[model samples]
Target: MKRINRLYIKSIFSALVISLLSCSDDFLTKEPKGVVVADLLNTPKGVDNLLIGAYSLLDGAGSSNGFPSYAYPASIRNWVWDCASDDAYKGTTLGDFATGGEVERYEALPTNQLIEQKWYVMYDGVSRANDVLKALAKAKVNMSEANVNVLSAQARFLRGFFHFRLQQMHFQIPYITEDVADPALVKNDHPVWDEVETDLQFAIDNLPESFPGEPGRATKWAAMAAKAHVHLFQKEFPAAKILLDAIIASGKFALVDNFRDNYTASTENNKESVFEIQSAVNDGTSQGFNGNPDSWTTNPYNRFLPTCCGMYQPSQDLVNAFKVDKDGLPLLGIGGPKYNDTNLKNDMGINSADNFVPDTHLLDPRLDWTVGRRGIPYLDWGINTGNEWVRDQVNGGPYIPIKQMFTKAAQKDASHTTFARATAINYRLYRYAHILLWRAECAIEENDLPKAMQLINQVRKRASDDFVMGKVNTYAFPSSVTIDVDYTKPAANYLLGEYKTFPSQAYAREALQMELRLETAMEGNRFFDLVRWEKDAEVLTKFVENDSKFRVFMKGAQYKKGVNDHWPIPQSQIDIQKGVLIQDPAF
Candidate 1:
């Protein structure tokens, strides 16, 4: 199967209609003068159109819908919630997205507007999935059984995916379906994990291993990955292990040669992707949201996007996470979450004019790729002007994000949209590396320490040897975002190490945890991973206490797990349900 060539205009045009279709809408009911609407839609084309509409919302790029433009906070990147992770800050200013600041500080409340918007976007996705199923049911077209099976499977897979996203945020949520007559009366009294698993299993059992020409469509492997994730989230170790074993054994996917490939537009939807959210730019005449507009605010100011928004700043403590020992293994054990080494400081306290020597620690090569720090080469954007790119020093910190960015060479793929900063760089919802690490997690859970160690090393070896982002010399305009640059002079004193052994299950677990953080850090999985491991309260509370000196917004922030562990059911949703929706008791 072809991994990626480039997303053509046809695929993009059909996949971005979710922004136009309202959540309350079924199939478009109205017809022009003589055409019967249902007759046109009761064919294979109609079913496919609804399916495409379902695919469109995967980006959650949001809609205008008669209001002044607003990118609802449901980006598939999960950056809004991802910022709450210890590794990132809501970086621009405390006043901007103050609710996001509350989320970061662990003072999250049910009334938070962003939380409400996230609820709306996720439900909108679920409704879109239902739209596909509803259309398929009334189809008068003479279609093969295989076609029916694939169509239903893809829709349920998406339904499971969207509901799973919501359940991860609010533990108690209603599992809405096309069968439900009155959604507002639906209750959130029980867990939706079982329903989510069933939907995914149906998809897994029915979907083909690959869709051949359509790389964006969900496949059996995608369903399997989603099912395994659902199992892992519920701590169903044996169940998750079975699915993961199948996926790894299939030999359908593997890590790409370069880490930059995972983020760059030109290399998107590559072999690394198990499931990737596809985004694309139009030639200025598309009717719906073209690419990922919701992700625009995360871009840096002055240096890149015209907007002053630079939220999702890398934390100083996160930079410390990249430090490796003489053997190249992460020194995460040196200190707890916040291992403050003055040597790793990227001009934090010093004046720009002062003659300062760079603190070159033996670091993980992934650091510069994941974060854009002072003097560090930021893609082809030349050496990053770190402090100058920062919107707020005291709260946002010195580091800028780099992983969400596309290389300068692919700007047309990333930038040519109505939202000038809108990017076509696909978000890898699940990649081959994710399954490899999860397999290691399963190994650790099974107490097969050596197997866990081996799997962890498998992932580590890739980071140690991949062709990393090298430097170019132009300062005015980014000369190169290419990894093929002069590696004779590297971007940092980078050294990566592999684990020799795992002495105990605890040690194996810690190693896996640290590796997961280092591997997927800014991609937005840290905070939730901690929650999944039942370590949020313990880990995040400690992170705040230690890193508060570096980030003033966290100075006295207290983290109590109730509301912090899971977001409460949105107040507006509960009101609409007319007291039927039971809020998360965790709150």
Candidate 2:
């Protein structure tokens, strides 16, 4: 409702490339980049771009001028804010995001720019989705029942998602429907999950399982997944179990064979993808707005993108999470809070050209796929030498995030060289593994430890089969981790084994929770998951201290319970809404 674009900023909505061309020469061709056409509101193309515009903001980048780096606070990836947990650092320069210690620590305030940016993006997405619905209502004259159902369903699904994202961040939020006369007047009075659920249910009732040619479009199963994901946050185990069971029963999704497949652009919309926010490049626009502009700052600094600013480096605590026992089971088994006590060897102050050996600790194979440790192969981008790929090893740490990056070969079409962190990579919002783990949570609650073990094992089985490997031409690890010159061997001392039994409900819960962390680590789910499980205060308080030992910038950081669970409503929005909106309690 309080749009940054309509006021200080120009256009927050993405530029829908609408072409109105005659069969004549270049004079007849008029391609409007940012403005929505008033005349084409009833035409099919206008409605289509409005729909696409709703989908576009999922990446948190927009405008016809140029690409906004995905590292910004609004990115669906949640890299900056989610770092408030233990998974990663704000990285790059210490004062980066220019937030000081706001996000990385719990020093954030109502006036933080990141908070305002993220709030507006979510609301912008809601506004765009409403636009599609209102336009469709007026234009339904030329549409069939089936077409309208699918199109309207998609808009509702997006509207549900944008509000759901808002709910995840704040304690109170307003759910704006198309019927609302003035969204600014809408009160953040009661909980919006019921409204969110209704929208998603409509999507499930009308959406198809697949869109035939459109892989990015939301399907019925994807809608179910979205609702089930919210159910987890609400701790609605029975309701969540029902939805997840129906999805698995549908047999519509499964994990991709290789763990690496989930990260690369080539394997997007694979078997595991439940719902992916689509991005593209090189479709004739001067700027690649359709690509992942959000990724610009989360990668290794400058080695790939010449102007790359990302250093969303993995934490030493997160690295220690991969520690496995002799049998390859996690060493931090069954809620040992000291899981991060022993860190794998790192190259903190070491130079790039210096000799550094890869850590020989027995680790889950997913670690290599998730993190870019010193001596490991970072996808197809060659062996990661400490400090070379990172901007400041002292502040950002010795590792970079690998899961959010692309394989070297995938970068050709996946990226455009012009300010090219805008990758064509599809952001996997929900994967099949997520449903399995969500169900595992239900199984744990029911004291069905065996069922939980079985579900958790299904995910680990996939991890053990896939290990990161250096490319044929890349440098090899120090023989301790590799056997051949082509780097045919697994990159790290990778070992992922299945659990035989859960032993008890407590152990099963801890194991299941840890599995979720190992699986989704650097993808920006850590902080919220900690909060969802009510472990944010304990984990994050200790996290800042533990993380502070290495990342000096977080030395005095703290996470206060009740207060830090949700970010404060941005002061800007509250003022704009007058008395209609109130800030979250205590901050």
Candidate 3:
């Protein structure tokens, strides 16, 4: 959405690199070199630069070492969250990312290195945000009180955002601020929801409706939307509804005409994007893996690219959840017959060389947009070739991720090839469609079935209208074969329609839940949604049971309620902090 200034971004990167190179216990505490560095930070220019540094952490890249690793816990893509949920599988071949496999199988221990890495990265973000506020507090340059307030508001917003992420993953976390002189002394034992709300509210009050030159920066609407999301997760329906209604009345956002556009680089930061993590490629940084100072790159291409490691495959249960009846409605009956028995076409047990066709039965139009199935044109990368494209189909199944990838046409400007496929595809943390579904959930919980149904149908209508594929001239295979296919043809027996009315509140509740799962299938929200609904055990237990039948790797998987509700506080963190952080139950 915003063409981030290369010079400005590079300056921020340079500062971060210098701080990292010093090898201090805390990078934020690094002393400024001289008048140039100190004067720059004390003036208005310094405040802006510091703000950019705080924003840079949104990508979850906390190092200047350049190598893209899954160890970065704060990755906006939510790879770990997706794998832990029933919507996806740890698609990489066995013996690769074994720690990730443990997470996938519900066997993660405090010793899991990935968990520790993530804990550090998220706190790193919190620390950066606090540094911005601390810098502003002691600035020697002349600045208006209003300007200072705005900067503080933005910094606090980020602080709250990072803390909220920790709470979501770990359930209990210490809320750090600029006032904290020594973070090591903080305890991860208390709830920080009140502090989070205060920070977000400050942002909502101070942020402008839009930043003209900085499109991806947080805005008033972003703050409100994020706070609303927090309330929804906390089951504060009425409180969340007030914020959602205000957002709708603001008239600053709406769903784009095409659902696929929300995922592609060609149409990022459109009308629907509420808050997006900005990424950049080939930005004149020679640092290679570590040198790109702006934290504006991602490794989804490397992981999701069929030819690469092929991690994060969509699950068959997720695919089957997309099935619709003749009337274009989800086949509804919770705790009833599993939908996988409906003869839905799948590529399990079938090889890439085998003659197979995608299920042509009536289905939701959003399925093709959310998943890369066999025989479907996977953007410009050609038809998905089953096992050939998958790293291990028997373990992870056939589907590859689609929503987070960039197209070949857009890759020139949006992607870079280092050790992995790093691209500038912004990870959308909040979008209009997400807001609609969340508001629907609020309404449903409040017993406002009529209002909930209307909101749900609004989202469904958008998916139905945005189902058409883009124009493609020719499809090429990785093995040097090319073929022509009608780009306008539907990839499956696609059919979807708006509900005339909800049969009852129970039916409406089920429909609303299904809508959330389908609308935000693999963007890392599923497991959390299950937890929020208090249905994690029921849904995931059924998911493991049904999916394990075909996906052998998941045979022993189980979801123990209360225990699996939150990941154990990383054991490494506990030992390092000398028991400042207590482990959650059933660890």
Candidate 4:
């Protein structure tokens, strides 16, 4: 339970592998280096170090195969998920990350390298987790049986976590475990939910409720939360509710007073964090071809910022989704007066340097926190000058991502300088707010409208605290003009209110769905949530139809009902297994 330095652990891992290489024979032609490393991993310290390596993969980088060309597939941020949904556009030009553009347009094929690379990185995580189990079983260490159980449980949890991510992307993926001696012979013909659930259950039963010293390591609460997430996706409401209720009663977590704190580095591993990926910089490691030699660094700053490639632009629809009524409730759908109407206002056609006014109308405070629109404070960075921050406003729109970008003051301590931008910001995988919303969904499915409304209101009330504005420090443009103002002032007519009641089950469900979209926005769960609720077709079809009007890139995008629900099994993977892996139906 000690605060284990990830950099120190990685150093040990590197040194051990380096020590195994002799001057005589090439280690590549002989037994795999992992086999040699596993032989030395017989002591308790060695087993724990191996477990650390498994944890390192949480960043979705650091593979021995070298970094993936684009950070989308490898980074835990999963920008592709946001792009695939209505929440965001594949920013930049058409030719940049062309395969990703195909995904955004719903034209993805089995041969898309983006999909294939994602499959490779996730499977590599599975293989690494399995390696820990293989080594643990063979170890001759004189550790207590309880200690071994905990280690084995941690390894199984990681294996399940990696497989679960694959399952979300490719529903019928192969669930590789320690039993599988050869992964190439495995088949992706069956649903891995059963295996994933089983592994998570073991982890839930074995992991400690809290690890005070090691904040980022998975705990019993995290395992339970992850298992419940799987159940929610599978529509097992009763099952999910039980775990969620326990987490809520455990008093282990609570939403931070300021929602923006969840995204900042200075306040990481706060009370709201249930499980977060650990990232560190300036740890004395040299920056590699991509960024830091350590694959844990995030590259969103490279692409999402306007000063850079300006990829992952927030969609106009998403910006409009934040519009609230006079009473602070969301004006839902395109039928609403404010919906998709220019009255809501944006920088779509305006130049950044030209003097223009931002739409200071009724809006959700979270909108400014989530999207860096023109004229608003962008977390200690200068006021977002629309076109100046945008690479090509004509193609990508005029908004840049804000949640993951580091503040200028914290950049030295939080990010790495490279050919592209990279940062040490930890990607929050599970948080208490997500738990609240998932529980609310379960309540709605169980016909507990009052309970659902109450839970939903709790989330809203926290968001409506109105203290977030004070937490943000505004900066002047041109590095000269010193115009001081109250940070508490509404950025853009910010108005968000709690739900009073729900007249019908349908109404409650609709409100719950919209709340999730508004709350999470661009954190990469929109597409998956829609799929889980079986509302992908209804939601995305309308989103594409409406969004295409403004975003020319989405002109031909279509969300096929059943086929698009799950991505196709990579053609190369099926070919590698020689038909052992069956493609999803209709692929």
Per-model TM against the reference: 0.89, 0.89, 0.90, 0.90
Quality of model 2 by C-alpha lDDT: 0.75
Question: lDDT of all predictions, in order shown?
Answer: 0.73, 0.75, 0.72, 0.72
lDDT of 4: 0.72
Off by over 4 Å in 4: 1-5, 8-12, 15-36, 68-70, 288-307, 333-338, 341-343, 417-420, 467-488
The candidate, 2 or 4, that scores higher on lDDT is 2
Better of 3 and 4 by TM-score: 3
Better of 2 and 4 by TM-score: 4
On residues 124-158, what C-alpha lDDT tens digit does candidate 2 reach at each position?
67777777787788788889988888989999999
- Candidate 3 has its poorest 10 consecutive residues by lDDT at 291-300
User: Alpha-carbon error at 178 in model 4, in Å?
Assistant: 0.5
lDDT of 3 by residue, 1-587 (tens): 23433433466544653353221232223344564665456667666766766676666664443235633345766667668888888776777767778888888888987777667666766776776776787773478887888888888889899888878888788787778766777887777888899999999999888888777788888999989988977899999999999888888899898888887766878899988866666766543222222222222223335234567778888888888877888887654544566547777777665656555577898888888777777877666666676667776777777777777777676666652255566678899988888888888888888899899998998888556353333332345556456777666677889989877778788898899889888788888888988989988888788777777788888878787778888876677667566777677
Off by over 4 Å in 2: 1-39, 63-71, 303-307, 333-337, 470-486
Q: Which lDDT tens digits does candidate 4 get at residues 172-231?
A: 988787777666667777888889999999999899877766887889988999999999
Better of 2 and 3 by lDDT: 2
In Å, residue 486's CA in model 1 sits off its true spot by 8.3
lDDT of 1: 0.73
